[model samples]
Target: MPPHPRTTSPPRARRRLRRALACAVTISGVLLTTAGTGHADPYAAPFPAPSMTPSTLDARYATERRSIEQALRTAHGVGDTGRARTLGAFLRPGRRFLDFDPRGRGQAVEVIGDLASARRVALLVPGADTTLGSFDQRPGKPWSTPGGGARAVYTEASRITPRPGLAVVAWLGYAAPKTLSSDVLTDERAGQGAVALHRFVSGVHRVNPAARIGLLCHSYGSVVCGRAAGSATGGAAWRRVTDIALFGSPGTTAWSASALGAARVWAGRGGTDWMEDVPHVRIFGLGLGPDPVSGRFGARVFDAGPGGHSDYLAPGSPSLRNLTDIALGRPESVTRA
Candidate 1:
């Protein structure tokens, strides 16, 4: 028998093939809409009129609890301590139920502040392995505890000068992946979760019509945001979303921002984060279109300093400072410090 010819694909060709496959997977994972539909009209009536009822609120809470529990179980099975901690925060009584079905698993929006006076509203969407328990830390716990990112951002925003009448919400209202492994990258679970996220944002606007909402999406949460923002259906109300920020984001490109009609798009990635080297490729219907930090996407990229993936919101991290500045409409001077 003739000797089988040795397979000799060059390194460059192999890399190209991998990139192509990744793109295919990403595209297959996300269902793209050709036409815009659900975005709320800019001149629509103010939110929180007769539309939000007590009955609707109750139903939302019940569903959200179930979703959070499911995420916790999944994280524990995968041995993801960070995710488990986050889920623990969600299970807490008051902190987890503050927002209405933000994750689409069914939760009601808990009004923590005076909504009527708020000039700007921010919805903080967390990424992989997120759960209700990840919102705040118990006393005496390490400052490096999980789920501190969102809380830190909220606290920092609260302390900003001329805080712009802001309402910062920690929204763990999406079904995020339990780990960073690529196994779950383009699964339907995440895509369905994205759909739910879109509905939640719209629901929020329906209740708080006049608020200028900003979406702060981190890590894989950026994927959820991209999918939700591009959704023509429930995204109609998002026209009021003045700014969208992504940190340590896996995806958030000009294509997504333009599709979402966001007036401003900002991105930052920590220099030490592995995502800096992650190839920009869509896979199996997963991933956002392109990298926003590539500079070609027109996003206002910022310096996130030396911490890796989770450093964006680290205490005293430049990225977190910049985030507060953008949320408060302050200058970027703090970011340069």
Candidate 2:
């Protein structure tokens, strides 16, 4: 034969393959995302009690670090390659994991600086897509990794002028909804997260009862903080919180900041934060409620500049600077929105 016909896949077959690949990718994203939305059954297993508050890190560090190492080994053995790398990095020398449980997806508390002597503590509650496996930050990634934003905040906290013995806590304590999934649209996960956050905050207070505690919640985390704020009245732990600053918040379910029950509530959004486009209404408890940054919501607004949704903690940005100022109790220097 002078020539042979070339073999090629049929167009329909090619289309089918592409669709299959897209679906697989979507499912992978959902599965691998640390910030999951599914409601966790409280009865699944007996969860361990967190460390007693005010316990010196010396008493807790050795044991917790061992837990992290054991969890890392389990991840590697189970072929959870993503989680393996994440847990491994966390086991690096000198890095202390305040609390760690590798069971299921995982839960942890990573401190940026010394917590024992710090007079000011910033507890960062992250939004969706935060899990131990996905917590590792790689350059060129956005909000997908916890290290990006949490590390940024940690670094900025240390840079505060006249450094105020501040320690930043990157708490991946609750299960967050998968980003872009239906879970992000509801408050179920937030409700659960709120309970855990409340407990964590209470324990934190017991550790350094005099520390000036501030909550810096981002995205759906604002919903968690909002829920915790509701029942925090008449409690000393809740009263210890000085400022509740929300950025890129979806909603807080409250009509006004005063309803959050914090001493001072502040809200800010990057000029281009897409969260502003999310609807601000409650529907059968399926929605995020109201936008905290809206004029009618009545939160003290701060300057977040014209950054995007993920840029709130970008170093040198006005949002980061303002947050540092607020954390240091220098509200007078914060630029107004």
Candidate 3:
């Protein structure tokens, strides 16, 4: 018998095949529509977004907390038991929100550390499978819920930050797609998220013009931030960002680093991250484009170590430390890949 062509495929080809196989399984989920989700999101009238910067951080925290408390009362009165409980838990004792919207999968801007005094602020934008229900609950061990992951990352960053003047915000300001849904296939959802994010960033600038802002975009959240980078409310709002960090990203919908239309862009992927295998192909707008970590794509690459799809923000991980260093504008401290 002729010698078998031992593993004819190159590593890149193998990686693409692996990604294709993985995506094929979930592609069916892409067919599911909002109605097909089997549950409709509860709708609440628009709550005002914080526009004017507060004179004091305490005042802003109080304003946000009062709004959330009121929303909690409303939910309880209207028999929205789930949302009410979620809000109640968040309000218990020592939690703070810069913004809160209970309608449609919930929206919250949660702060960790002292935002008012922090010279550095990092906004953590999460990916899919996140909703009001899973925000605080992360019984899933290693894999965190959107809120859970944000909190985990914040906690981890706080531990590693060299300077005490830093804060992290878990900005769940838009409706996220279910992992098994059509929403993940297109940029439509990201477009909406971009608008919200821009507005939120604007609000942040208003509140703390002097504080340097960094965006930590994770997974599908990278798509949202990519959209926001292009759809800036203005040059000033977009310019306020000191760094745009992407981790475990499928793609950023950008052609290159400059294409992101933002400040310095950084990319990282865990050694075990499945994203490494995903094809950076954009097909009929149903796929991602421009792999951020690829040398040709040209985003500053940072070390993210060996961790799975959900482990980049794992507490005490090098990925989290690298992320904190970038957020703190300590580029010299970052461990580059």
- The model with the greatest lDDT is 3
Q: Please give the TM-score that candidate 3 achieves against the real structure.
A: 0.85
Candidate 2 lDDT, tens digit per residue, 1-337? Answer: 0111223434777545544653454345445644545855221222344474565555566767777666667666667677777777887876766677776666777777667667888888888766767665645544325555656766666666556688778778888777656677677888898899888787777777777888888888888888888757667777878888888898887778988885688899886665654567787866677789888888989999877777788778999888877776677888998
Worst 10-residue lDDT window, candidate 3: 1-10
Per-model TM against the reference: 0.65, 0.82, 0.85
Query: lDDT per prediction?
Result: 0.58, 0.73, 0.76
Put down candidate 3 lDDT per residue, 1-337, tens digits, no spaces: 0111224345877756676866775577766655645665445554554454656556667777777777787888779887788888878777887777676677777888777567888888888877767676755443355556666666665666555477788888888888677777677888999989988887777777778888999888998988888666455656878899999887877788887765889999887666665567778887778789999989999999877667777777888788878878888888899
Query: On lDDT, who's better, 2 or 3?
Result: 3
Candidate 1 TM-score, C-alpha based: 0.65
lDDT of 2 at 140: 56
Task: Look at candidate 1 and tell me the lDDT of residue 27.
Answer: 44
Higher TM-score: candidate 1 or 2? 2
lDDT of 1 by residue, 175-198 (tens): 565543443355354466567666
TM-score of 2: 0.82
